[model samples]
Target chain A: MASKTSSDITVIQPPRGWSFPNLREVWDARAILLNFVQRNFNVTYRQTIGGPIYAVYTPFMTMIGYTLLLGVLFGAQEGLSVPYPLFSFCALLVWTLFTNVTQNATTSLTQNTNLIQKIYIPRLVFPLIETCMQLLTFAIAFVVLLLMMVVYAQPFLWQIVWVVFYVAVALVFSLGFGLLFAGFQARFRDMSYLVQTINRLLFFVTPVVYDSTLLPAPFNTLYIYNPMALVIEGMRWAMLNVGEQPALIPTLSAVGVSVALLLVALLVFQRLEPTVADVL
Target chain B: MKPENAIEIDNVSKVYYVAESVTEARGRARVLRNLTSPLRRLRATLAGQSAFGAEIPVKALDEVSFEVPQGKILGLIGKNGSGKSTLLKILSRITAPSSGQVRIRGKVGSLLEVGTGFHQELTGRENIYMNGAVLGMTRADINRHFDDIIGFAGVGAFLDTPVKRYSSGMRVRLAFAVSAFFEPEVLLIDEVLSVGDAEFQKRSLGKISDVSRDGRTVVIVSHNLSAILSHCDLVAWLNKGKLASVGNTAQITSEYLLSSTFESDTLAGEKRFRDFVPSDKYPFELLAMRTYDDQQHVRSSFLNGMPVVVELEFKLGAPKWCTTTPSVRCIGCVGLSRPICSIRDRITSTRSCKFTAKMC
Candidate 1:
């Protein structure tokens, strides 16, 4: 008979502060991530009648709210010969992505908190899924927003090409900000309330309900400090060819801010990742 | 190749900081000011609050390490807060440790709760794929095992019914079947068998045993001490988030059970069959009875048909009562509160009386 070895009884531990994920090791669990995202999308719709229909229709309702509140109620001028519905629809397209992604990301760690504490997957995956799911919603809403713009704006503006570029930037910005807030919310908890408040405040600060022409030169420069302002403005310019072209300097500054925030968010999230299970 | 160990958790430790108070202010001034408020701090401290609700770091697991060899079943025994679930979660990759690393050799499937990933709106069939997907099974793999999984769950009648409509027992059975069939290299099961009826429990256990025999590793966390002891070949005892002992199942379980001081109950009863002659009016006999351990040792101390000796002391009243035999009755095995027993032999004495009997 052969003798048993100690490895037969004892588990081996990994090195201290191991940060880099062996991609292949993580990749093997790709089915889990895909299933989770699919489940979330399916669940979100299954709870309602014509679920994907609602996802598509809700953006139009939001556009009506913006049309009434910003276009008719507050009388924010719609320039570049774009109809209020077309312009507001464009803003809604981008803003919904930002808001939905942020909300999903912020609550990702907290709501599925039990799952977070019980299993170990890359923590980043939860928020990333939220972003991707909302992107699907964004894509559905974008088609309607584009059709309205072409139908009402009197001509097909190839300027709609810029929508893709703006969407990419918006996504990166959302991920960056979403990560920062999600990490903070995991710890402080007060960040949950703060995130909602910030979202409301940001609606006014960004051109979501209005045009960038409402702002003067230096303030437009100051607007870049709020990265979403450039994103919203760029989105409008690209989708409706509305208002002033966002200056290159401010655009570059916005890009720079987004990159910095993304790096910082990753670092902060990683540094705090180890504590998340404990805190939660 | 000889199968590698399924899981290797080395020196895993997790530390949690409990906030004393909900209020935490940013910067140095808040800290200094809070220090001066002794009364507030005292009140908060008494209430288990920290300045910023003071952070008291608790070590959930401290330098704990263990392994489950391939195809072997390991039982994790621990008191409440012993970090057994925490250890399982780390191995399952649900939570990260504060320090240390865990490397699992193969695909890990976990059933931390009976319905850990079930969606209420999705029907039984839909959730099968959803849960399968969550457990790292590709759709095609799930398709391959689809009939086996559904057949094992025995929910064919309600296959299209939303899971919310299924009874809790049905849900547990289906969820457990899904987990069992996923066929990962390592399976982490946490107290899932406690959910269902005895027949279901037996089914689930049989499934788990089959998984182990198929050259996969299993780590089980259960409060059913006897179940764990009987099923596990290797047992690890955890106390207060630390490893109390680890080795052979018998040695560890006995040590774990005996180390605790069990309280004894004074009022206990036993059952007996006796023939007693009635004095004047009536004559009857006692049929059956039982004695209960007051210290909650009923299961721990007694097994079916085990002989137990009992001693009884009493004061005799009168000779007239001597004709009646003392008899005892045992009752309340299923749902009755107290066991009823009769004494067979009657005693007549002025002083203290002692009688010894063996309980059947």
Candidate 2:
């Protein structure tokens, strides 16, 4: 109905499909996203006794416990070439990053109800900002991984660069589920519990604490399709060379699944975006 | 030159679904909710029903439309639940309307909240940048107005101090100052002038009027008629989610003020059901209402200083719940944003099992 054709004129309407927030607009608001990431990173550790060092504490302590039980007590180290702590610690760091980032991403929209209801920043930007916060933690924890590698005299493998690839896949996989569950969580506030329970079950299946090759024959073949297993096995192969190397077909298939989940989750997010302000 | 009109709102409407619980436990809904909650919800979801209850769809805004001409100050006035805020929210794109079209020229900035996303731990300086970005201002824009914002908030000495240490007045002023620097072509203001001290309120009004004079269209929703009358060139009256009237400030405002009284019995052939405000805090529903003079004749208009009795009838939801006393205090006087009086409680008709509150 607007008679003007100047670029300055904007027409607002009852939204059709076009109302789904565009990526370009989200990119244009990158300043706001940076602010969100910076604020969370700065404020989250301010009142803590150990500050941001808490990021590395979880993976380190859990590795010690796993080494005592699985290596020293159970002789679980017999099947591995590298020390149990190094192998499990590498797996734990990747798994920890995924879980921490995923949990924050899942609850991002519900947690910032104030900002969503008042400010006009894109709703999709929140999950991205929250996911970015976990990266700082990963950066801090990666330093510890290097220190432990020096302690055990594990030679720095050129394949160690593949750790970055596995981390990227891990992040993408976590973000996919995070976006998927966030939509459900908005309507049903208890949906986060369901998400955490699923993650706990997945923790066992992904071989975070145990070696992947220990699985029964039929289950070993089926494990190739699991995205988390892909991340953990790929990280173990690249960093420690302690497990069966990730095969090409399985790695490609798992990455494809991660990308597919993200696309599907985006559709779900678009469907629920309009109702967000009302429900919250 | 810019477009003739900065905004074109076409038949805009918004609908909200308000869920109402079907069966609440007698005076102890909390206990029941705590026990059988998740299982009941899962069953309800499986059966395609809401566990809480059925949702009643409410038409928050009907098909009403009005345009703000370029450089004009438009005031949206209505009582609570009249869709004034809904319209503002739609304009700001905080929520999409259910149906209709709104054409706006240039950028749109909404002052829907003061200091939106303000971090308690961040310093006043950091908050200025963060809050500015939250309001859709770019980094360059905040930098351009950095000193002005500090001067306006009067927090120059404490710019590096944490906001948690600032006094409440300082915090509000700081927030208002950041929002006041936003330079969108079409600005939506929703009751933000009521924040801060009286001095800050006056300063905000001045900044808004100054924005209008600079060829920016401003839409302000406020209960303060005096502020609206003094600043607005146009006034729009919304009644029951519909536009009742809109025109020059003097005419529309006067017409709206006369018709908005709760007890307007004199308007013949009009059944204003919205005159009865829904009490969500209590289960009781208002059945009917009547006003009476000292002569025992029905009346809504009264001479100056003459006291009248307002008899309210409500249908009690639970008989046993009437054991507790309920009080009603009429909020906000005619066209004024202050409580004039809480009428004296004269009677409680418990024999009929219907609670009645009478006030002076």
Top-scoring candidate (lDDT):
2
- CAPRI category for model 1: acceptable
Total clashes for model 2: 4
Per-residue lDDT of model 1, residues B237-355, tens digit only: 99888998887887777567645422252323433344443423332222333343434232223322333333333222334555655333322122112221223544344332333
DockQ for all models:
0.29, 0.29
Native contacts retained by model 2, as a fraction? 0.63
The runs of at least 3 residues in candidate 2 whose Cα sits more than 4 Å from the true structure, single-residue gaps closed, are A1-6, A15-20, B25-53, B262-360
> Lowest-scoring 10 consecutive residues by lDDT in candidate 2 chain B?
B351-360
lDDT per residue (tens digit) for residues A1-280 in model 1:
1112223232224223324433464475567777777787888888576768777676688878877887888776434467788777777778888888877788788877867765556677778778888898888777776567557654656776877777887888888888877865665576678778888898888877666667787875586567788887887777666776678888788788888877777766665565566555
lDDT of 2 by residue, A1-280 (tens): 1122334766777655523457887897898999988888888887788988887989999999999999899988887889899989988998888887778788988998888888678788988997888877888888888888899998887788888888888888888889877755766787688888888998888888887778999988897689888888898889877766788998999889999888877766765666577666
